[model samples]
Target: MSYNLHQLHAFTTIVSSGSLGRAAALLNVTQPALSRTIKRLEEDVGASLFERHVKGMQLTDIGAALLPHAQLLLREAENAREEIDAMRGLAKGTIKVGAVGSLAAHFLPLAIDRVLGKWGNLHVEIIEGVWDRLAEGLINYEIDLALSTATNDSDGIVAVPDCRWEDNSFVVAAFGHPLRKKPKLTLADTLTARWAIPPKGTAPYEHMRETFLSRNLDMPDIAVQTRSVTVLKSLVAECSFLSWMPEPMYDSESKAGIMGTLPIPGISAARTLTAFRRRDGILPRPAARLLDELRSLTERGMAMQTTR
Candidate 1:
């Protein structure tokens, strides 16, 4: 009379679909077979699970109480199976990773490589967006983990072990811009320039704006507002717009004659890059290990930097 997982699934399906016939359609089982499973489950509990009416069946109090517990049990089972499969080095599961634009530009592709190298059997998916979308995804269970700068606000997502990463960077512009020729750049110099800005409501963009605010500077009339760092960098190269970015976003265009940087006093523009997941619990091993490799690769990439 003891219930098994299948019985629990059947009962839950009946409650969810509101009728045995509908539940059979949803579960892809014969109506009689599904009805028998529900009957068996109810007998095991020694309680009626549903009361039939004109439209469909309604869960009795015992059934209502069991619903959440049954769902949790099934979820745990799925997680356990994933863990076991991961331990056996068998890949073949889905993980949604949230990546902010700036980091995704440089580090995320490398991180993807490391994930693939380590977990060849697993399929990895990346959800690229700014911090807020990523945070929303994590909260809505749309993403498994997020790589972002602003983990300070969320209580529902857990930051990873050893989550510290840097965001401070030098102000950048095309080569031979007047400030680049100066011995050192001052906060006042920032006012003289047209600046490309990040879209509103993002960590990097907000951090850049905050830097200006902290220095008692007016928001540099955003010469251009864009979500694409690539676009911002291109504008810096081809046109006359200065933008702020973490050093990791720096590249040959930034180093060669195309772009130049000026040292702003007390300006590390320090930002934090962190990984967050469901505060409710741990990731299944496949995702956990993949995440570990990704962070290690990012760490190695960052360690190569000589932080000023």
Candidate 2:
């Protein structure tokens, strides 16, 4: 059945704002009008979308399922308008990107800077998280692009094959840590060391586990686990904890002599980084622009490595 954009907007706004009155205020319409819009939408759907309550409105199961589809349609409609505006010389659009901590630290900023330099009017929104969150953002249409460690293509998200690169992961510790004094080191030496890392099941955590398991060593007992990059870095730098991280994620700290990679011969490994997008829908132009910049930067980086 066909649905009106106004009705969908009102429905989603109510869900976000948590009440008819607040949504009406935000939409610059009367509460009665907002209510009517939702009623019509519910009629169109042939289902009670929300249950009214003293505190606030709550979504019915159908409404909960419809939210993502509605949001996706709204986002696509906005993208269409932005595309027309750009063609008309408005040069205005928004790029929604989600990335893991490592890419957000350096590579993403470089590409974003280039995009902003060229299209100063464009708006950009970024969410930094692990792969799971990035993938969720893609499926929900919250982000048009995702930069993350390479993973198998899942239900609604697919990698952009050409937009991939490799980064090295290393076992690192603060420069002042006792391990730095050792002329030689092995994975076995780190078994007794306190460790901090991303939570179990994350790509970084899995990589660390595999590194130890490959050599028949048990994973070290983790002293702390966190998703916050700042917390993890502080623990490693100030608390004498060892951690595994991609080079870019800790590059600045390394350059500043705050931390250094352990010289364990086989602990370092390469991980493939990839760009991902929703399997369906045409990517918005602004995201495409940023993706182009990412590709160019990756090519330049690879070229420099080749020359070296």
Candidate 3:
């Protein structure tokens, strides 16, 4: 049975967006048209690709198996177009970058600015989420490159050289939080305090949990669990709630006296942030340049921390 590239792409987009309407919107097509494409593709495959419900679409086992292959095909097709464009000496193309929250806010703009300065015609789409989700986007080709605190290998993805970092020492507590005024701080002192933390199973969550466990203490009270660093930071700043985050995450606020790092020593550890991409493909010049800028930023951050 033969499959159409457009149909496969529609299927992939639907899987990514989780709803027919959203997928159609992303593809700039009508919902009816997207539905027809999926139907035809399902007929060609002889199996239902999704489980449809009133709320959203869920991929079937078959659909799950087909997704990676479809993504690879789509990526190759895109690469072909980009290569041809490059051959014509056009320095224009969109780069999709996935980054974690802090990097998105702190480093992504700087990197984007640098790349845009060199290639004024380039467009960058920034998608921010937890590291795991971003890594999945990189593997699926939904994002061309990812900046995240993850170094574990994903299939068909490679980490660029010297991109890993272990200097993200995070601390918990907010400015004027009573805990900060204590003569001495300990894990037990902060156990009863409400906390905001990353969602479960993420590196930050695991790191915070291990930090508590290593001290032979029970997990602290988790008052809020979310993936958005903006929300986490806001809560920590405006309320007495404690949250854990990298030192760089609050440099500006802390300097403004709007936030404070509690002297809770030994509660934080180094987190590795790495940039990754598909192992088999060559990045277009725009993506390559942005990546170089990100690397340079990481290097500068490390240097600044060393001198502190």
Candidate 2 has its poorest 10 consecutive residues by lDDT at 299-308
Q: Among these predicted structures, which one has the highest TM-score?
A: 2
User: Which candidate should be chosen as best, given lDDT against the real structure?
Assistant: 2
Q: Could you report the Cα RMSD, in angstroms, for every candidate shown? A: 5.2, 3.0, 5.6
lDDT tens readout by residue for model 2, 96-136: 99988888988888899999999887889999988888888
Q: State every prediction's TM-score relative to the real structure.
A: 0.68, 0.86, 0.73
Sorting all predicted structures by TM-score, with the top scorer first, yields 2, 3, 1
lDDT of 3 at 124: 82
Question: Model 3: what TM-score?
Answer: 0.73
Give the poorly placed runs of model 3, Cα more than 4 Å off.
1-70, 86-91, 280-282, 297-308
The models' CA-based lDDT, in order, is 0.73, 0.88, 0.79
Residue-level lDDT of model 1, residues 11-121, one tens digit each, is 878877788889899899998898788888888899998897878899889988988678656765777887677667674766678887656766666667777776677
List where candidate 1 sits over 4 angstroms from the true fold: 1-91, 109-112, 176-185, 255-257, 260-266, 294-308
Error of 1 at 30 (Å): 9.7
- Residue 38, model 3, lDDT: 95
Question: Model 3: per-residue lDDT, tens digit, 90-204?
Answer: 7457778998766675667777888888777778888989877887787666888888776667567878877655446566566788888788788788878889989889877
Candidate 3 residue-wise lDDT at 79: 72
